[model samples]
Target chain A: MLKLRQGQAAIALVCVVLGFMLAVQFRTAQDIRSSIPFQRIEDLSQRLSQTEKERDVLLKQVYELRQTTGAESATKESENIKMGAGVVAVRGTGLSITIDDSKRLSKPGENPNLYLIHDEDMLKVINELWAAGAEAISINGQRLIATSEVRCAGPTLSVNNTRYSPPYEILVIGEPQTLENSLKMRGGVIETLQFWGIQVSLKKQDIVDVPAYKGAFRFEYAKPIKDGGK
Target chain B: MALPLVGLIIGISLGVFFPLTIPVEYAKFMSVALLASLDSVFGGLRAGAEEKFDNTVFITGFFTNALMAAGLVYIGEGLGIDLYYVALLAFGLRIFQNLAIIRRYFLRK
Candidate 1:
């Protein structure tokens, strides 16, 4: 009986170690599955897709409204105002520009960030397009309006509060030949971008479509001042 | 037997309450160690049932086997040879054999 008791103590100690390890291993496996970075990425992608679906539905409604509205002079004037305000999608012969990060590897000791597309680079391209008389402009399907902003949100570009990853596709509605000449001019935006190994491709298409702005226009602070007696 | 079962429950609850976490990189090593310790426990149980339990041998074997299994995994990662499978297969086979022997010993008694 004494011998049995001694053996039982040894077995009990070993069992303790085994049980502890088993619990820890189970917890570790569960931790790996729900790691913070993995969960964050999944959540972000789900929100992105949801917002895109919502935009598509709103775009369909815009087209339906345009179709249902009769050809009266007042309705025609409102349609023109909507087009100018970038609230309605437009299609015309224009230029489609694609800008992406450089595929070329940087030399040792050089800054790798130079190869990436920056907010300023995109802003410069948009400014050039506007100067060349682009009637409408959209980047990665997000339209540019009077209140639209082009800013950097970490590694991604945020246009009008919506974030997009490269390669950025800019669609414009204008005279294709004129737009192309302005961008491809000597020592222009394209040449500057190419010098740092950034990839820029400009295509002159017969028809280019730019999506309308999907965000709301809030005027809570600034009431429109009457030019004269209303 | 009841004492060992109670010890196991205590150990599991202790681990749960400690809030300790190992990094993801060392998880593989922890798994190998867990397998080794499990195999040792069963081997010790079988020896005890057969009336041949040695305290020194049981304790040393438990530590040495767990450490060696973890070392093998580390070496395998360095050499890029995947020696983890070897340790796993050996320990797995031993656990089943020890369980069967313990079961037979109880049946005969």
Candidate 2:
């Protein structure tokens, strides 16, 4: 009976230790699943890849938007260039001037040529309008550009190589009051022309139209420098 | 038999209540120790059924086997060898053999 009782006590002690170790080992395995660095690293890598994909998609969209806006801006720039080159007709509030030869007979010893409107008089009037900030100008439907010419073609006046007899109509686009003041200033172009008995009339209009340059542009001697030049 | 079962239940509850934890690095040694203790328990049961149970042998074997298994695992890790597999195989076979013997003795009774 003593032997049996001793055996029972030993077995009971061993069983207690065995059960405690089993519980602890199970708990430790659970801890590893929750706290291990390898599992955490795997999760973080997955999130990083997802974020990178989203960034790449957004970058592609940005490039596409820039491409579209770039094309739109290019067209807008070319339109401005054409307007400044006098290749397009324009209209705005401005002044109109009509000038012709004097109808009165010349006095004795007076020069009759002074009573006629000369190309130099027209050039002086145009220059004054330009100085007063004319956006556009035309004479007898011929637009004035950088290459336009105004000179005496025999008895008639020539503008942009086209001849026109008086009375000449000059259309200018600008502030009407400013342009009128510029032309009518003391000892200005209009005052000089009126002293010679030349007929000159100035009128302010709500809208003045200037036609495009009709002459063709030929580049025979000049070429645009490549690579924006040195 | 009933007393040993009650002791086991008490031990599990105690382990559950305590918040003691081992380091992650020593987890392999703990597992080997656990296996060794389990093997000793079954060996003791078999000896008892055969009428040859010794309290001193049973208690000493329980502690020594657990310590030896843990030491073997530690040495295996330091040497970059898998010596724990040998301990595991030995313990697993012994547990089964002891279980079989206990089952036969109980069947005969």
Best by TM-score: 2
Q: Per-residue lDDT for A37 in model 2?
A: 69
TM-score of each: 0.46, 0.46
lDDT of 2 by residue, B1-109 (tens): 7767887987898778779766555778999999999999888888887888898999999999999999998777656578999899999999999989888877776
The candidates' DockQ values read 0.27, 0.20
Query: What CAPRI-style quality would you assign to candidate 2?
Result: incorrect
Candidate 2 chain A worst ten-residue window by lDDT: A1-10
**Candidate 1 chain A least-lDDT 10 residues:** A1-10
lDDT of 2 by residue, A1-230 (tens): 11233488888888888888878888878866765465457447745875897699789867766777778767866887887789999989998999988886665566778788889999999998887768899999999998889998877999988999999999999889878977875446786787666888999999888889989998899999999998
Candidate 1, residues A1-230, lDDT tens digits: the string is 21243478888888888888888888878766665566467447745875897799889867876777465646766887999999998999998999999986665667989989999999999998897678999999999999999999999999999999999999999878868866765446886788777999999999898998999999989887799547
Q: What DockQ does candidate 2 have relative to the true complex?
A: 0.20
Task: Spell out the clash pairs found in candidate 1.
Answer: none
DockQ of candidate 1 compared with the true complex: 0.27
Model 1 reproduces what portion of true contacts? Answer: 0.61
